[model samples]
Structures are given as structure tokens and as C-alpha cells.
Target chain A: MSETTREQIRDVIGAHANLPVDIRELGDAADLFAAGMTSFASVNVMLGLEDTFDVEFPDTMLKRSVFASVDAILEALEALGVALV
Target chain B: MGSEVRAVSAEQVALRDRLIDAGHLIPSGVDGVYGHSAAFEDLREALGTRISAEARTRGATRLTFPPVLPVRQLEATGYLANMPHLAGTVFSFDGDDAAAAVQGTRASAHEDWSEFQAPTGVALMPAACYPVYPALARRGPLPAAGAFIDAGGAWVFRHEPSTDPARRQIFHQHELVRAGTPETVLQWRAQWAQLGLDLLTGLGLEARLDRANDPFFGRRGRLLAANQRAQELKLELLVPIAGPEPTACASFNHHLDHFSSTFAITGAGDDPVHTACLGFGHERIVLALLARHGLDPDRWPAEVQDRLGAPR
Candidate 1:
């Protein structure tokens, strides 16, 4: 994954977080919900991710589980063949 | 905080209970969720007759509509934008053999088949006002000034799962909508806001009119709430149901040109039709009346009982 793509994802997540989120703390597999991301705030993050990446999310990608955390979102995007950066 | 008269009837209670027993009414057992039951038909028919009679007095046309609407049309109106969470979509199988396989099923399989077919038709309508704009637009330009349509509807769904009868998933809405010149539409909405408040008051409920924001959406939905306050798009007549906070039974909406522009509905001289709608959630009103009044209809004031045409 490109460093730019990683930065964009972290930026989207950090923007929605009420407090500063530690980028290092989120592995590519961490649960977002368990990390305190709200469902609605996560949607905003997803929309931001979609816009920044110029990628459209399929219906299946819209589920809550895929967005459970910063790591999960990146993994799901990778699975969808969305190239980082 | 203030006390109000009760106006519930034994008949209403009996009907509600019977429907619940029949599984027609699926109560959420929560405070605000509204449920549906087969018994609603009787109450709805009666309400429809009463509303139609009132429409005649006002020289309005009575229009009835089906409960389901095309998903495409709803999308065009931006209903998905304002109420995506509440809107229910109908899905169907694209599988070629799905239908035939269902028809070939045995009795046990038949039940599953029916469930499979349930998604085919269209989205269930969440509000009555939705279907009217497109129909009105199909007709040529609005009259020189405006037009009033009295519509009675049922099977409207909301996603709220409150136990309070006041907030049901499926309920009836007796609506009056106006489309035309800006003055006409706004005036009609304002008039109904007062009229609805009076009607609720006469029903023996202590009701008040207040500005209402859109139903809660997501986190950003709070933005929608703020916008509603800024634009003053909604006014609701609310009555205390089960607690200190009041439940909205009727709402008057000044949609401006939202529907008209979205649906291409124009008024005389090609002006965008200014649209407004007054929606009465009938079941909520009934619940408010019941909560305020006792279960005995005969005990209600003569004037209040007479208006509902309850037999003495």
C-alpha cells in the first residue's frame, strides 16, 4: 500500500475522532467500533474515504462490520482492489 | 405538566386489543413505537369518512392512494436524502428460476416461497404526501392560484420502534396538501397548523404547537436539525403521551419548492409550484386522546364525542 493512501485513511479517521487518535495504535486489523468509532461518524469517514480515493463503495462494502476500525477499513478497501494512494 | 381531558372509547380499546390478539398489531412494547393491526381498517375507514366530509365542507377533492410506491420515483424526490433511514425498499430476486421454483414448492416450502416473493413489488411508502406531487405534476399546470387535495392513507411505515402507540412503525395519516402560488401554499399550511391544534384541543388533549426538527438521522443529522431551525420548515402540534416530553401528533410542513423543483411540478405561468403539506398521524392522535382521556368513550364530553361521531 502507498504511504499516501495510508496517510489519507489516517486523516479521515483522525478527522472524525473526538480526540486525537494514535495512528500507531491502529493496526491494519484493529476493530474501529471497539476503538470507539460511532456508526454515523464512521459513515462520514467512509464518505470522506470514498471522495479522497475517487472510489465508489459497492453495497456490500457499506456494512458496519467492514468499518469496524481504521485497520478494518483499509483491509476492506484492499480486498476491493482499491490501491492505496 | 398540565392535566387534560381523556376521550378514549371502549370501542377503541376493544378494537386495539382484538387486533393485537390477532397478530395484526405487533406492539414493540416500547414507549414510542407504533404498531399496526387489522383493526386499523375499521378506524381508518371511519376517519376517512370524517375527513372526506370535512373536505367537502371546504370544497376540496378527496383522493385515495395505494400504500406502495416506486422506488425510482421516491429517489427522484430526494426522499432518500431527507429520510433514507426511514424509507423501506422492496427487493426481488433476479434469479430466472426463482419464481418457478417457488410455484413448485410443497406446503412447507410454500411459506418460504411467499417470504421470497415479498420483496418484489416496491418500497413501502413512509408518508402519504410523497405520491401526490408526481400525480399532480402529471396533470397540467396548477390552477391560476392553487389547489387543495385531501388524502387519507394507511400502511405508512417509520423505522421508530417506540412502545408508545403514538410512534408506530405503520399507521394512518390524514393529510391535506396544497401546491401552487407561494402565498397560497404557505397560507394553507399556517391555517392548518392552527386548525389542527384546535382539533386536538377539542379532542380534550392539552396540545401545543412548536417547531419540530426532522426525525433524528445519523450524527450529521444534527446538522439537519439545525438547518430546520434556520429555515423553519416544520411546525408540529404535540401532546403529552406517557411522560414529560410531548409526542407530535400532527405536523405542518412548508416544503417551499423542494417537491415542485424535484418533481418538475409547476404552477400557473410556469412558476415552480410552492408546496406544503399538513400530516395527521391518526393513530398517534388516538393514542394521545386515550392517554389523556380514560378508556370510556361515553364519558367524553358531548361535543368531543359528537365530533368523532361516537354513538352515545
Candidate 2:
């Protein structure tokens, strides 16, 4: 179930991260920004996460660490009370 | 806006007091807002003139703008989303006398009167180059050599309020913008950085160029700033003015296809044009002079006086 949640977050990142490398090749701890994800792309990833999980990120969570990696995004979603399957 | 406490260093206070005592700056009972005396204005104007002359020698076209910008244009820049904390929007009462009376009452009682006010069609210009791109885009493709513009000394507004005189709410920026191929823009930006450093040194002010970043707001902004620094997208000419940290009297920014794509600014061949701009803070430069030399321009070094051309 936890892997399902991770997969969902990865799917959102793959759709919006704009990473130069394929999403499948990146580990959960990979730095998306260092992999060519721009600030604008990070904003898109945030929006995609909000839509996928039906949770709005507060201003406090609008940070680089929150969207730094797939694991980071999952952590943020969990902090926002998205129940992990 | 009113909740956060702004810290002003003792050094800043001392510097502010000195300028005020020397009759160079007139206090407006508001932190970060002051009126310039004739001497101050004269010095600032002289700096602008010197910069304009240099730009003219480079065959740059001159353009001027007022302090306010069209609200629509401001929104289109995406500044509010990126740096909303620093943006200042104009708001005014839009109702009849009755509504005015209510607003007046609220104001008199120190109550929130914002409800009675509406956003005006104009916003204070955040930077001198904000309007340049849109204006250039309307003219279709640039010349084969692209465009270089001297934006004159235009007033720009930032919302940071502080007791530091160097950090004024409203200030003039003697700005220049260049648009063309990536090579053109980068070369222009580099040339200006060297020129800017030389200009400050010629004024007898100790100046140095350093990698810099805008004070992007919020947590997300931190990442943007880091990326910007890593890419060396911004450079600032820094000089010690009032505090321990040097003040940035001038800045050069290379907007890699950001403004061009946003405004659809294209090169002669219809390729996306890259843009770059450099802005010298008029007031800050003068303050640096005062801090480095003395408040009296008459007593400055002979060479400095000669270069700035004997105060009008």
C-alpha cells in the first residue's frame, strides 16, 4: 500500500517534473531540480500533486524541500494528511 | 504588512542621521521614504547624465517612463506570483462622497479602510525594464543587430520599509536593456558590468562586482535564488554605504528567454530573443559617494569632481 502511494507520487512527478532523464530511471531520493526540473516545473508538480491527492499545499509547504524529490513530495503529501494506502 | 517588525541596525541609524543632519535627505516621517535636497538631486542627476552619455556613445536608443505602470502589464509579468511580498499596487476609493466619508472615518480611527478602496488601473513600476519588453514586442521583430535601449533614470517602487536611508521605498534606476541573440545579450551584460564598476571607481567610491540574486519571497523562492546564483544570472556592483554589508548600487540581470518568451519578443529571424538589463540605483550611488567621500560634493576629490562634471 505504501508502494502504491509512492507510485502515485512518482506518476505525478513524471507527468509534471520536466526532468531531462526518464522518471523511471530516477530513485526516490534523486534531486529533481538538479536533474533539470526548473522552478516553473516545480510549480506544475505542486499543482499536479494537489489534483492527484485532492490536497491543497499551504504557503508554508510551497518550498523546494517539499518538492525536491519523489520521496520529498511523498513526505509533503503525508504531512498534509493524505492517508497512505 | 503592519505586523512584521523591521530591524534597523545602529549603523544604518547613524548614517541616516548624518545624511539628515547634512541636509542631503529630508525625512518624511516614514521609514524608507525621504525627499532629496537640491544637492542630492543634483548629484543624482549628474550620475544619470554620465550614464546616459556613456550609453549614447554605445549607440543605444533612449526611452523614458513614469513611476507607474499599467496594472495589466504588471500582472502579465508574473511578479505578483513570484515576489508578491515586494510588489506595491495602487489602491484608491472608487465610490461617491458618502463612501469617501466612511473611508475617511475609518482612516481617522486607524481602522481597516481597504474594504472601501479598489485597485487602481496602475501599479508602481517595480523595475525600469518591466515595460521595455512589451513595448519592444509591439514593434515586431528587432533590427538585425537587435535592440539596445537606455531607459533613462526611471523611478521604481519596492514595498520594503526600513530606517535605512539606502533602502528607500521609491528610488530611481538609471537602467539599460538589451535584447537579441544569447551571445548579444551576454556580451552586453558583461560589458556593462565592467563599465559600471569603472564608473563607480571613477566617482572615488570603492566598488566591486559580485554574483547576486533578487530577494525572492517565500520558501519556493529560495530554490529559485539558488538556481539563479548557480547560473550566474545576476550580478551586482556593491559598495559599502551605511551598514556592515555592502549595498548593491547597481545590478545586471540576464533573463534567458524569460521576458522574450513571455512577451513574444523575437529576433529578425523570428527566433526567441534573449534579454539582459543593468540598473544603477541613483540614490544609492549618491549615498555611496557621500559615505566614501563626504556629504559636500564641492569638497570631493578633484578628479571625481571633474568626472562627475562640476555640480550643476
Per-candidate interface DockQ score: 0.03, 0.26
In model 2, how large is the Cα lDDT of residue B13? 88
TM-score of 1: 0.66
lDDT by residue (B1-312, candidate 2, tens digit) is 112345678998899999999999999988788999898998889889999999999989998888999988888877887788879989988888898999999999999988888998999999999989998999999998999999999999998888888888998988899999999899999999999999999888889999987887654566566667767999999999977788899999998877897899989985658999999999999999989889888888889888987573
Off by over 4 Å in 1: A1-85, B1-46, B93-121
Q: What is candidate 1's CAPRI-style docking category based on DockQ?
A: incorrect
Quick one: how many clashes does candidate 2 have?
A: 0
Worst 10 residues of 2 chain B by lDDT: B1-10
Global lDDT scores for all candidate models: 0.68, 0.86
Q: Which tens-of-lDDT digit does each residue in A1-85 have in candidate 2?
A: 2468888988888899877789999999999988878776787788888889999887666667778898888888888899987
The reply for model 2, stretches above 4 Å from the true place, is A1-10, A14-37, A46-85, B1-7, B108-111
Task: Report the CAPRI category for model 2.
Answer: acceptable
The number of the candidate with the highest lDDT is 2
The 10-residue segment of model 2 chain A with minimum total lDDT is A57-66
